[model samples]
Target: MVRPSPTLRPLLLAGLLLPLLVGCRYTYLPLIPAPAEVALPTRVTSAALTREGGALVLRARVEGRFEPGYLSVAWFDSGRELGRDSVYLDAAQREATFRLEAPEAGAYRAVLAFGGNVLRQVELYEVEP
Candidate 1:
């Protein structure tokens, strides 16, 4: 059987504990800023139904301030994506308008993506028979 010398035993113990001491002092740094507050659209001013056409006219104003970067809009129906659009903004825009045709009646949701963050807003409408 072989045994470490007394001097070597303390050195080996210190080497193992050194990693633990350093690891305990370690902290994780955030890579990006935390999500900021996003304001939901206040009114659906241009939303309406027309008897002349089978499609429903949908329009709304989304108001919010976000960090300047790539922005995207994803339109959803009952959690399903119907369409999406993307835009690049160097400066923050407080308001934007979106227009789309509603082929059928169902619940709809809108999601805004900026950088690595996402904000969601939802609305529901029904078509008359």
Candidate 2:
């Protein structure tokens, strides 16, 4: 029978134990919960246009982790739907921003849809000339 040299024996032992040590080190990491399919908007803010005769730009910040899908933006003016814009997100993003130009001088609602669900809805008012 042949025996491994002293230096080679220690090297072989370390190679065998490497995987066990790495696995145990990661055992304490808590598993993060999967984001909900339908997450409501957590925070929202709106501001009026500062310049006169400038179009009102409604900006919104929506927070959620949506599945790989398309996000749609809809603009509503005075309880009536005006227009919509859609964008595709291939991977998960922590948040998203949407902007819509004011159609007329009035109150407007911006709705964000993700995976066929309404993720956020915000209201803004446009001043008249």
- Top model by TM-score, which number? 2
> 3-79, model 1: which lDDT tens digit per residue?
99998999989998997888886366685769997675322223222222444333333344445555566777775
lDDT of each: 0.55, 0.60
Residue 95, model 2: Cα distance from true site in angstroms: 4.6
lDDT of 1 at 113: 57
Model 1 clashes, total count: 0
Candidate 2 per-residue lDDT, tens place, 1-129, comes to 999999899899999999987887555445776677875443323322221343444443434444566667787777888788776664454334455555457766777776777766766665431
